[model samples]
Target: MFRCARAFSTSPLFKYAAMTCRQYSFQVFRDVPPLRQMRRQLLLDRKTVGFVPTMGALHEGHLSLIRQAATENTDVFVSIFVNPTQFGVNEDLSSYPRTWDSDVAKLEELNDEFARLGGDTGRISAILAPTPKVMYPTLPPSSEVDGDGSFVTITPLSRKLEGASRPVFFRGVATVCMKLFNIVQADRAYFGQKDVQQTVVIKRLVQDFYINTDIVIGDTVREHDGLAMSSRNVYLGARRRAVGLVIYDALKAAENAYNSGKLARSEILDAANGVASRVLSEQQALSPSERALYEVDYISLADPDTLDEVETIDPSKGAIISGAVKMVPLEESKPGEDCGLGDGKVPVRLIDNLIFKPRP
Candidate 1:
């Protein structure tokens, strides 16, 4: 960590350049206390900090957040921790991707890009990648937490949409985020818009608790075919990636309907589900055993604040239009369903959404 000798500099750029004019060297802290001490030092030095938290398996989606943080803050801090509290009994906690080396390499590449730009602010300030023992010190070493420890759970919102299926999700998210926000004490924190409910939950956590950090939502980064980039996208074999496109298509369709003056909730949601049904139906033409099984888990039109399903569009206060799709290979399909030779041998859950505020 470099100290800012000229803390009273008039120009922030000059101050950043004065502080860091050498080759970029970022630190990765494995524990909380030391990281907290460093954060304190950054504040004392008056350096602006932007944070991005992830569960590793970095992708362009994550990089976009990091990139934005680098551009906006004097120093960028990133945390990569795979919290076990979020996973369920049958979830893939054990098999979830943990590309630590690759993640770091990607960060280094981002740093190089920042260097190429010749800007001192874009360098990644540091990384906080802690172990389970570090995050849950009181608990024993295990893949799943005991749930006996303290956690942050926002009611009704946590029980809706994705929460309806994965109950422990928002609790884990809120808890870990609170801990990180406290430790980093960053000026701002960044999150992707892909997880619409998640962004709402985090916003609530920050506001209710009066956390000092500002929450910045980055735009969702998608693939060439419009698939919203996600670390879990790795689960889909090369051939089956298109099967997941239905969610985004549905969301865009819903957004289009809302923009077209279709204000009724049914009209908006029907537009979305209508698109999804057609996509799934076309896939159905494939023999049950030949392609992946697709099911629309939920198509929701809800209050941006409460997450309660809404009956109509509110143009002044935009609505959150979202959907989830369950994609499983026919071979791995449950006992009742006939099996098929499909692209995804494992079950992959896809969620995507867009806000519905029509243009004037």
Candidate 2:
């Protein structure tokens, strides 16, 4: 027979012991705590916070900013307040999508993921769920009077583009954003380049008001076919969607002309118009039902910073090409025919921009 110690070591018990030891060498992970718990911990830990303000119908475009914030900042806060003051009387504020449940779900999902990755979940907070009365105190009855305004007015680089169309828009945006910055106390803020004008105005506001938030701008996200990602794109029907490509095509034509030694502003505008005209003409050939329906508002190229119309591309200064098109509805009668709608209006406004930076 074998010695007792040798027999014990060589037996299945010894093999099982070895296996258990190997398994023990590897680490076991417990389930991560929920974001709410992690956030509380982070807040207690004293982390710096960043913010992104949006009218939520959150998309990849918005998520990209959050991801950037996650990488660079200790905390991230997103506010989703659609301020009524920004919208014109005839604008789509009434029909603008507001999916609060889904928006909160997305924010919570992002917060939890960040938390699991050891990021400060408390940093990625949202302030959209509060009731109107609680968030904005009731104004005195006289505050609505012609000269009894209680809200502070922000005079920014308005009087152009969306500002020209919606005069009171930027004032409202600036005021609401000021409130958001005060509430969040963010060290940095993220904005997409799609709204170049709005970006300029916000920068001015921060500077003039002495707000201490660092602004970061993300690239404008676009569809595979080059149409800029926008919430209003949902309103486009089949034909209108096809016609929508004209905007992108026009922008590209203008860019190509600028790059290929064509410096004349008129020539560039002509190039854009050429592309738009071709598409419009083709659509006009189709039956009213088959044709895409839209009204071109304006096409312009301007200095990205000053927002003034630029005749020549300055290699040092960037330019922004922007325009708006109104979409007509399907099931409505022909262009001149009234569908009982007063102005024959199906305002599916499409706004897009292309930003050009000089080569190094």
Candidate 3:
């Protein structure tokens, strides 16, 4: 029987005095050899593996995936690598949330929950928390366009929507994920719907690459107020956090509007844009200075599959209405001043989406 190390119980992060949860320890590997060896052992034992890839900073949204994996597969491997490749030059790679201690605690919490439910114990058997150096020992030379270092790319799909905004984002995502898929060799891989396009891209990647794994997408988890949960959400200041709700509200409105028999693409876009505008207007009215803090990047209606703009929603096929907004915290500036966001303002970009399907 696997036993947790006594040190974990006394560790600051792993202390469970709050509740009488079962104590257990899963192997954590920092290098590739041990991880691969474990996978080999699992394969030799004829056990199926479910994989959950994450950037740490665990939340309920992430927990749902782990729970689903534990319930379905004989073994679950959760990777806690904060992949640096995915972040853009101007992105929050440095400032991105990294609560390693809290993350491990959440993993422990899930294992205990699984035990409490009489589900298979020790389902969460491995955690691969490799560092950038471990994942990629050598950096690409600067002269190369993308890089002399190896990378994976899914054309067309990688160049659309989210990719359009952050050009190299999907390439990095595809490369790292493909590496994970190769290393884990999981029977099933799980993803969340919060990143709708990313899920689509990964699904396509699996199909095209002929990887022997099933891709499962969990529903997007939301806060009580309907705001989609995200790791970047920690960057949102109080007012900006409240203001960010507009994305969800806007998507809900768009879905409702599509259900109301208005199929025109322009009309649907206008509906979501209107809701977002109203939310922004109200916030601005409450405090005019907040106006500079909220900016709608784009509101688009597109075919869910191809992600191309659709003139009409084929209720049978379904469609997606999505948008991104730039939310910033208050920066001290006079009413007539430029707001000067570079100095004190904390800006974070948020994205949300909704799917509309007509009733059959």
- lDDT agreement with native, every candidate: 0.79, 0.66, 0.77
lDDT for position 1 in model 1: 54
Q: Write the per-residue lDDT of candidate 2 for residues 1-360, one digit (tens) a residue.
A: 111111112232112122122121111111112323434565677766667787877777787788787777776767665566667666777666565446656766776677778733333643333323323556521212132333445454677887777776776677678877766567788988877788888888888889988888888888888887776665564456678878888989988887886766798889888888888888878887567766777888888877889888776775888887776665444555323222333457777778777754
Model 1 scores a C-alpha lDDT of 0.79
Comparing candidate 2 with candidate 3, which one achieves the higher lDDT?
Answer: 3
Task: Name the candidate that leads on lDDT.
Answer: 1
Off by over 4 Å in 3: 1-24, 120-122, 140-145, 286-292, 332-344
- TM-score, candidate 3, is 0.87
Q: Residue 206, candidate 1: how far off, in angstroms?
A: 0.5
Clashing residue pairs found in predicted model 1: 289-340
What digit string (tens of lDDT, one per residue) describes model 3 on residues 1-360?
Answer: 343322212334222233233444677766777778889999999998999999887888899999889878888999987677777777767666667668878888888788788746437888887656666778831212265566888988888778877877888888889889998999999999888889989999999999999999998889999998888777665556777888888888888888888788888888788888788777766654444457888777888878888998787888888888988656544446443223326578889887776466
Estimate the TM-score for candidate 2: 0.78
Candidate no. 1 TM-score: 0.87
